[model samples]
Target chain A: MKARVHIMLKTGVLDPQGEAVRHALGSLGFDGVNAVRQGKVIELDLADGTDEATVNEMCERLLANTVIESYKVEIL
Target chain B: MKARVHIMLKTGVLDPQGEAVRHALGSLGFDGVNAVRQGKVIELDLADGTDEATVNEMCERLLANTVIESYKVEIL
Candidate 1:
C-alpha cells in the first residue's frame, strides 16, 4: 500500500520560504501570483493491511511538525 | 475556491532531505521507519469558478520543477 501525506503551515502562520519563492516568481515574470504558502509532501509505502489509525500515528510521531504544520493523508 | 497541489520526485530519484529527516526520526526514537521521500505542497486560493485547465497551466509554467517533480491538483 502507498500513502501520500501533505503537511502545511496553519493559516496565519508566517512562511518566509514561501515569501521568498513568491519574490523569485515575480522576478521570473510571473504576474498576479498573490501569495505562496510552502509545505511538504511525504510518500510512504507500507505493508499490506495498514490501517488509517496507524497512518495517523505515523504523522503524529514522525511525519509532521504539528506545532506549525497540519497534515492530511491519502491512502492508495 | 482553493486547490491543493502536491509535487514529488518520481520514484528512483535521490532525496537527501528525506534521508536526513529519516535519520533525525531515528535519533528521536522512532523505530521501523525505513525510508522517507520529501516533496512539496502548494495551496492556491483562487477566485471562484476557476477551472482545472488554468490550474494546470499555472503548475506547468511555474509551480513545479518539471524536470524532476510531477504534480497533482485537487480543487475545493
Candidate 2:
C-alpha cells in the first residue's frame, strides 16, 4: 500500500521560501503571480492494510508540526 | 487560476531526508515501512489564462532542478 502525506504551513503563517520563489519568478519575467505557498509531500510504502488512521497518527506524531502546519493523508 | 507543481527526486536518486524520516518512524515504533520519498509541492495563484505551458516553463527554468528532479504540473 502507498500513502502520501501533504504537509503545509497553516494560513497566516509567513512563508519566506514561497515569497522567495515568487520574487524569482518575477525576475524571470513571469508576472501576475498573486500568491505562492510551498509544502511537503511524503510518499510512504507501508504494509498492506496499514489504514488511514495509522497514517494520520504518523502525521500527528512525526510528519507535521501541528502548531503552525496542517497535513492531509491520502491512501492508495 | 491555480496551479500546483509537485517536484520529486528522480528514482535512483538518494533521498536522505526520506531515509531519515523512515528511521525516525521506526524509532517511534512504526514498522513495515518499505520506503519513504520526500518531495515538494508548490501552489501558485496565477492570473486567469496563465496556461499549463507557462507553468511547465517555470518548472524547467526555476522551480525544479531537472537534472535530478522530475515535476508534474496540475492546473486547477
Q: Please tell me which predicted candidate would have the highest lDDT against the true structure.
A: 2
Question: Candidate 1: where are CA atoms >4 Å away?
Answer: A24-32, B22-35
Model 1 vs truth, CA RMSD: 2.8
DockQ of each: 0.48, 0.94
Report how far residue A8 has shifted in candidate 1, in Å. 0.9
**Model 2, range A1-76, lDDT digits (tens) per residue?**
9998999999999999999999999999999899999999999999997989999999999999999999999987
Residue range with the least summed lDDT across 10 consecutive positions in model 1 chain B: B25-34
User: lDDT, candidate 2, residue B34?
Assistant: 86
Docking class of 2: high
Which stretches of candidate 2 lie above 4 Å from their native place?
none
What pairs collide in candidate 2? none
Candidate 2 vs. true structure, TM-score: 0.99
Quote the lDDT for A35 in model 2: 93
Q: How does each model score on TM-score?
A: 0.77, 0.99
In the range A3-74, model 1's lDDT, one tens digit per residue, is 778888998999998887678667776556577788998877666677777778778877887998899998
Q: State the lDDT of candidate 2 residue by residue for B1-76, as single tens digits.
A: 9999999999999999999999999999998888999999999999998989999999999999999999999998
